[model samples]
Target: MKKIVLTSFALVGLLISTSCGNNKKEAEKVEVEKEQVTPTETESTEKETSESSTIVAIAAANENFTTLVAAVKAADLVETLNSAGPFTVFAPLNDAFGKLPEGTLDGLLKPESKETLTSILTYHVVSGEFKAADVVKAINDNNGSFVITTVQGGNLTASLDGDSVILTDSKGNKSKVVLTDVDASNGVIHAIDTVVMP
Candidate 1:
């Protein structure tokens, strides 16, 4: 009887040890799977952020548009440009702002010049999203020149100048679109070489 009891206890101990070992192995496998999945989830999140960024966010992320970003903020148009409805923005680079006559940019940023600044900034924007291909098509359909109405209630003439899209502002100043079709969640931006004033 004593021998039988000892054998039974030993068997029970062996079974418990095996069960614990299996549970530990399962726990380790679950941890490994979680580790592998983390990076993929992070990558997906980053891609979504990039794809959903608005026009202002896209411009803010680029280094070339520092001046443009500043001007947008100064003009109090950050929210308007960030909203939905698919606007077409003619963005000017820092170099374009630099080409302005001395004190022009500084003067525009002044508090009293807010209305004037807003008008000038709005002149670069259109109501609907027009891609480069669409603009080209419009120009061709219009017999080499297409007139686009600005959000500020002025007209800009778009023409092709040797494969480049040129914009003639209300003041008769001209700007060349250097880069086109910068996609944004709210709109698209075409970078111009000069600021087209209203």
Candidate 2:
């Protein structure tokens, strides 16, 4: 009887030990799963936040602005525009750069033309976050035209070309805002079809 009781107790203990071990493994697996899931969630949120944070980031994300992104990096204006204070960037698309005179883009990308390229790029950036509506309103308020000072120390004239906003560079070349109100944490980007000169 004692032997039987001892054996039974041993079996019960074994069963309990096995069951406890399985539960521990399951708990550990759940913890690992939780750890894996948490970082994924956080990473997604961070990626979304970073994607819309700056003009550079926004331009880099768009396939059409590859040339512009390269130009920004070339001009060393990435950090300036990516800094702060609500800049309004009139970003030119790759097709717009193609519209430049032959060898113009190539010359500008050269190391010797850094100052000139920086001036041209900075000419596209105004020191404030002006959305399309605000820009139009300012145009209207200024009697059908508004002159905005750019980061390059040049002035860009904003006028209404029908329902669209047209930006005129100092050299009399005009670039129409193809897309507007690309809100970035640092400012706004208005994609232009033409690369405005300083």
Candidate 3:
């Protein structure tokens, strides 16, 4: 009977020691993890805060994209484009829209024409982030021509003309990229000289 009692005490003491040891180990591990993660989290938060402007926000701030902004609003795609897409947008400047045939823009802005406008807008956006260097590399590596798939499920042929990037739409219409790599939180924008068709 005494042996059983002593054994039970011994077991209880052993369990207490083991539990204490495990708790100590967990505490140390948590501290180390917190230390490692804190700096990275802080840096990431600061960077995101600094670059908080999204593609829609950036476009809205600029006067050059006034027509494009209006079209986006008319199409009700402003929210979609403003999402966390990491999209690559080939933005058309006001001059580019002005190059459209007379009364074309007016017709497209009609409520009944929203579907076509949405298609045209989404055609300008690729689903992923692609910087200027990556684009150039892709073009150079692919025999000086790279095909970029747009969010609209159509493809745009990207090729270099001297030092400029030319985007040819599925309709075989050509648009010259004027400004490259306008960074946004959700994506990047490359201004084109013409509003390419789907």
Residues 39-68, candidate 2: write the lDDT tens digits.
999999976686457889888989999999
Candidate 3: where is the Cα deviation over 4 Å?
Answer: 1-52
Find the 10 residues in a row with the least total lDDT in model 1.
Answer: 46-55
lDDT of 3 at 157: 97
Which 10-residue span in candidate 3 carries the lowest summed lDDT? 46-55
Backbone clash count, each prediction separately? 0, 0, 0
Question: What lDDT would each prediction earn against the true structure?
Answer: 0.93, 0.91, 0.93
lDDT of 2 at 80: 84
lDDT of 3 by residue, 61-113 (tens): 99999999999999999888878888999999999999999999999999999
How far off is model 3, as Cα RMSD?
A: 7.3
RMSD to truth, every model: 5.4, 5.1, 7.3
TM-score of each candidate structure, all chains considered together: 0.74, 0.74, 0.74
